[model samples]
Target: MEILDWIQDWFKDNCDGNWEHGEVIQITTLDNPGWEVEIDISNTSIATMNLAWIRNDNGKEDWYGVKIENQKFTAAGDAGKLKFLLGLFKEMIDKIEA
Candidate 1:
């Protein structure tokens, strides 16, 4: 719940009127029974980050991946990983801030 609150706050923080019109964030379900998150860093604080993708595939259902493409931060994981992937994004942001 805390992470979700933080994510809402982060979204609010980035809502500069203009950025909000671009559909900067998207959370969708994948047909493969999973979640997908795409956040457009655009002119935000993390836009300049050059972080590499993160992937973990321990087994069939225990798999996830994250990466920055163009100007968007993208991630996907199994059905139960929605919050976990968000947490990973938070960790990346925290790491940058730290």
Candidate 2:
């Protein structure tokens, strides 16, 4: 499945009556012309997992970083990396579910 669709399904699957109130996922744009994604994993399946920072940088247009901190999955990257960032999240989720 596409990254966005997988993300949506993950979000929908994790939503409890009150979990959505705190906002499980947040996506925003950076002033450096990049994408930032933060997903709250508290009370979710992957909340207990430990993930180190994952980063790659080849140039201004080719950089991405991801980490799990404070019970949340956070990632940032160049504009073109939005889908890639979400794909990372899906991969992690897949592993946790598997």
What C-alpha RMSD separates each model from the true structure? 1.4, 1.0
lDDT of 1 by residue, 1-98 (tens): 59889999988987887888987879999987899999888867678876578899877688899998788889999988999989987887888778
Pairs of residues at least 3 apart in sequence or in different chains that clash in candidate 2: none
> Which runs of model 1 end up more than 4 angstroms from their true locations?
none
On TM-score, the leading prediction is 2
TM for candidate 1 is 0.90
lDDT of every predicted structure (CA atoms): 0.86, 0.89
How do the predictions measure up, each by TM-score? 0.90, 0.93
State how far residue 72 of model 2 sits from its true place (Å).
0.4
For model 2, residues 21-60, the per-residue Cα lDDT tens digits are 9968999999889999999999687888777898899999
Candidate number with greatest lDDT: 2
Q: Which stretches of candidate 2 lie over 4 Å from their true place?
A: none
